[model samples]
Target: MKRYLLAGLMAVATSAIAAPPQPLASADVKALVAPPAKGIKVLALWSLDCAYCEENLTALRAYQRQHPDVELIYVATDPAYQRDALEARLKRAGVDDVTSRAYADATPDRLNFMIDPSWGGETPRTLVIHADGSRKAVSGALTPARVADLL
Candidate 1:
């Protein structure tokens, strides 16, 4: 009975540690880009399979450590069902503590269209939303210098 109890407790603890990613809707993405109460907002869109996405995330994580005042939002382009992988990637990137969202819609094209009509569904997309709500969107990985400039 003690062994069973320990196994159950272990399962519960593992589940808590592997919490699923939050579902991201079109409106959610829009809200992220909205004018913030203070400091600049950085929206980073990435996927688990993209190599450049990992590089961008690493750069962003370092930038976040330096500029904690900046609001960092990480949007995972992978489908919501792959939350486990997405969560693992975020943890590896050192951004597991930040606000994170995953693509909820099964049809990614619709979600892509909703996020940005001109996005072309690229990974490692970065958007710098200024305090005034004006945004600059860049598709592809961002270098450390560019990340610093964005902040």
Candidate 2:
């Protein structure tokens, strides 16, 4: 019983050390969309309340594992106040290692517009940005094949 308790404590401590999602403002969003120095950058937008977001996150985690060189950025569409919930979901998905951010602006609509003028404010939205700053945006849950094709 003591050994089990010690192991459980250690696990909890390890998880606590994992970085939590940062707050994302409109300026941050603009910076995120910029092209990377090398390799492709994947921006995945999700929400704790969206059922499809979980599935998409799982697929993204698997894809990241397969292609370690790809840059994966996860942005939780939930308000900044729900940071705890967003972090919990990211932990559950085993994706806390990736760069994570939560929408922080009071006027999220404006932020959404900045992200993409045509986007319908949907969860599970994905943007595959190339090194040249060009990108393809997809709105919906992504499958393994879809992830592969995007990369």
Candidate 3:
């Protein structure tokens, strides 16, 4: 019976693995904010170990729930190889369903510069991309005002 129970637990654990994120290359960063953006987009950058990243992701998820029109995009700063942990965190934050991507480039700085020149390799960086292609970047935990800024 103990062996059967252990096997069952292992199966459950394997089944609980979260969906892996898509790869985000530096070259594709501009496409997120370029023309034909269609709708308001919230691009959230985070990592597995970021202190405030989960809070920010939860806040963004809540904001997205309130305003369904806003597109939510999650970009994990961790490499694609760490997709398991990244996706697990996103699942816990309840934003896993939104478009998700992980950094595929070897040079993290290049990806950061492509996303936003002003970004200084900070975690929990959030960018509000307007339909008109203008972008507003905020670093740190997201607040009500920051969520409103997406509009």
Candidate 4:
């Protein structure tokens, strides 16, 4: 009887362990990557204090300036602190082709899985999904030339 009881408890615990963390299940990262229905999709993720993120954002900023037709979508991991700042900075930089959006820890929006399965909420990730569904994903900082080359 004790063995059967233990077995039942173990089964229940194992099922619970297999579930996605409660905080992550509701994340909106899954839904946030939708194309804006206008131009090429440039989905960029960043953290407020990440040096590499800042560098990548700078590169993107420059690229957007040169390629006005590109649809530049910005995603920040530190949405609370950097979203507004980023928008303001970009605006000041004459980054008119860009739009910034943020996702909380528990929203249904997430990076479109077409980009990657291992992303699991990694910041500084980007996917350039051309209007044709052809894609290029950058997992780290990339220079403007590199971005242009990807294009």
Q: Among these predicted structures, which one has the highest lDDT? A: 2
Model with the higher lDDT, candidate 3 or 4: 3
Clashing pairs for model 2 are none
Q: What is each predicted model's overall lDDT from 0 to 1?
A: 0.80, 0.85, 0.82, 0.60
> 2 or 3: which has the higher TM-score?
2
Of 1 and 4, the candidate ranking higher by lDDT: 1
In model 2, where do residues sit more than 4 Å from their true spots? 1-17
Can you write out model 2's per-residue Cα lDDT over 1-151, one digit (the tens) per residue? 9999999999997777577889999878779888888888888888888889988888987898888878888888889788888888888887787788888999888877787777888988988888987888899878999989878
User: Which residue pairs overlap in candidate 1's backbone?
Assistant: none
Candidate 1 lDDT (Cα, whole model)?
0.80
Candidates' TM-scores?
0.80, 0.86, 0.81, 0.60
Model 4 over residues 69-108: C-alpha lDDT tens digits? 7876666555443446655554544542355655444332
Q: Give the 10-residue window scoring lowest on summed lDDT in candidate 2.
A: 110-119
Q: In terms of TM-score, how similar is model 3 to the real structure?
A: 0.81
Give the higher-lDDT candidate: 1 or 3.
Answer: 3
Model 4: per-residue Cα lDDT at residue 35: 52
Off by over 4 Å in 1: 1-20
Q: Which candidate number would show the highest TM-score if scored against the true structure?
A: 2
